[model samples]
Target: MIQHKTLIIGYGSPIRGDDAIGPLAADALAAGPLPAGVNVISRHILTAELVEDILGADRVIFLDATVDGEPGEVRVRSLAPDASAMSTMAHFLDPRELLAWSQTLYQHEPEAYLVSAAGAFFEYSNYTLTPAAAAALEPMIERVRELIATN
Candidate 1:
């Protein structure tokens, strides 16, 4: 059997309202019919410590919330390492930079994709998801299902 070990990095602050979508995506994926041999992981942010985790994976997917689109919009796209995309993030690392790091540090590169749900209303102290973000869940998870089904 061909085993596809996929590492899912879902990062966002759970307490930061709509920012919680990333970790929530991890949960939705875990609860769904994810293919066997695929491994799921979640985090509040992608930091320096996840380098080794990325190195060992055959493929990787990143789940997060974005403000770059209309509320309730979901974006799914394949990602490649680009130096111009790198950022000096204080709490999180860009998915592109993560790919760049794995290649630079270990000469190991894996296919990467990003699934981002656009959200609005990131209210403070609101752990509950807003209606728009909640509406985005199904669409986001649907894309995730399709991404994982690919060899």
Candidate 2:
């Protein structure tokens, strides 16, 4: 069995400016030695495999970027399986739906959290994160670390 008390999965496309923050933060966390009982994975936000990946973990935190809000504004929220605020995209299953499916299919309902950094640029380009978004990474990681440590 895959055993872990907490899991951090950072998902985003690295090529899309601020969208890269999640993966970048994931890399920073991965480079350091994590506390016991914690695990982290950095990847694009795809559904099929991610649902299976989260099964049985006690707590799961998914970090990503969102364009619907102010840039660099970090929003953290506990998400339920049926939350209406979630976005639905055919190419990507909503995170809440994935959690619900995991509970129904695998009998696991981990405490789910989403950490989203407001995104600015989504267009094609060789771009870097804006200064504000870059500044938020450390605090976000620190918060995740604290959550993992306490839970």
Candidate 3:
């Protein structure tokens, strides 16, 4: 029973094979039976419009699919708003840049975390996760649940 406000943004493209992991994970979390106020969103990317939502939350978790590990590897790390990090493009923002924007523009700095899964493929495909990515879901879900529990 987490009383703190929490927001989870799952970003990735459904057509991009292993990238479908984020949205799928988001959907799973959204349907969970947890007793907490968890706002879940699935997006193709992050943008400035998300700042307001970030401002309203006590904590923010950004879930992204990456190529930084084995197909289903999961990494969760704390985030700080980097003073020098700024968006070169108005439309998209990585987690760090978005945190920096929230701190600088809105004068708010919610505790932030990035929970990412390594992706095996990014080519066009139907809404399907690669075998390794699929196997990764249970662990990812457990990790998310543990985060809320311990936070």
Candidate 4:
């Protein structure tokens, strides 16, 4: 039997309020025990170079903060490659775009998911999360754990 490889990427701006949740949660996960063949990474933002990282994984999970739902709410959604999801800016790449890169370049797109936490504040801060966003941290981590188990 072959071991499954899983990659977990948590990315966001560390100085931006609430937005830091992604990388922070990733740090927390890395500090604990994980299943074999699982690896965790924390990034300030997603970049095109990550396409190389995805090529070897069987599954990838992204953690980030979103303003789409109630503060402290956590959402998990599956992801697929989409070339049209391109970003005009050069600094960051959307998770889906990275997946698209893997699919186009290597013809191997790993099963992917985005686990996002709703944030109430996005103002510049000293590496801190708003109260509501902080409250969602555990739930966000728990959701990732569930995905790890079921996937």
Candidate 5:
């Protein structure tokens, strides 16, 4: 079986302007030679498959864009493995809900966390992230690295 110590799931769409933040940051991290046991994947959407990807990982960090919060502000929340608390965003399977279901089905739940960057524009065909969002990327990446390293 493949094993990953840290898995970073970056979910977003580049065509939707600031929604691209997650993938962009993921790309930056991927361009580098990451620490041992680290893996990164970029996705245009978040799905139930993410639960499988996160399984057995020492730490799982989900990076995504959110618009219901302040622009450029980053929110780090430790989600409980409970379906009800999961935000039913645009995802087919809410992440927290998937985690809950996976725990019941597989008998294991990896340490999961979400780091969201607030987005300003999610317009169609706008392939550039907002200045504020772009500025937040480096810090976010560093924060994630630190979190994974310490845990």
Candidate 6:
């Protein structure tokens, strides 16, 4: 029997206060026990190189910080490849853009989800999360775990 591969990528700016939640959550997950065929990666940013890694997985989960909702809000949303979801920055690529690259190059795209935590502050700080973001971290991680278990 073939084991399904699930890749969890947590990416954000480590120095940008609550923006560090993604990598922090990834690190927390990595330091614990996980089921077989599951891999966790903590990245400072998402880039073109990740498309190769993403292509190898059957499912992918992206964890990040968002400012669109109330502070400490945790949201889980499905993701799809959108060629139009281009990033203005040349260094970091959006998760959707990476998916699009995999689809264009390999003709296959894994099921993807984005688990985001609403952050109150994104100012310059060294891996520190604001009160709201810190409180939402566990929920974000739990949501990812539930996703892994259910789908």
**Regions of model 6 farther than 4 Å from truth:** none
- For model 1, residues 78-124, the per-residue Cα lDDT tens digits are 89976567666545678888788888888878989999999897777
Candidate 3 lDDT trough over 10 residues, lowest sum: 82-91
Q: What is the Cα-based lDDT of residue 60 in candidate 4?
A: 96
Instruction: Judge candidate 1 at residue 107 and give its lDDT.
Output: 87
Q: For model 1, which pairs clash?
A: none
Candidate 6 per-residue lDDT over residues 1-151, each given as its tens digit? 5567999999999999989999889998888888888999999999898988997898999999998899899999999999899999869989999999999999978999999999988988656888999999999999988988864
Model 2's TM-score against the true structure: 0.86
* Every model's TM-score: 0.91, 0.86, 0.91, 0.96, 0.87, 0.96
Sliding window of 10 residues with minimal summed lDDT for model 4:
121-130
User: What TM-score would you give candidate 6 relative to the actual structure?
Assistant: 0.96
lDDT of 4 by residue, 1-151 (tens): 6567989999999999999999999999999999888899999999988888898799999999999999999999999999999899967899998999999989998889999999988887667898999999999999888888874
The candidate that wins on lDDT is: 4
Q: What RMSD does each model have against the real structure?
A: 1.6, 3.1, 1.8, 1.2, 3.2, 1.3
Report the backbone clash tally of model 3: 0
> What does the lDDT read for residue 27 in candidate 4?
95
Backbone clash pairs in model 4 (N, Cα, C under 3 Å; residues 3+ apart or in different chains), count: 0
lDDT of 2 by residue, 18-132 (tens): 8888888888888998977777889877465777778747888888888867777887888776534345565676778778777778878899888888877777674688887
What is the lDDT, from 0 to 100, of the residue 14 in candidate 2? Answer: 80
- Please identify which of the two predictions, 5 or 6, would achieve the higher TM-score against the true structure: 6
Of 4 and 6, the candidate ranking higher by lDDT: 4
> Model 4: runs farther than 4 Å from truth?
none
Candidate 6, 131: how far from true, in Å?
Answer: 1.0
lDDT of 5: 0.80
Which ranges in model 2 have alpha carbons more than 4 Å from their true place?
A: 1-4, 83-89
Off by over 4 Å in 3: 86-89
Cand. 3 Cα-lDDT: 0.83
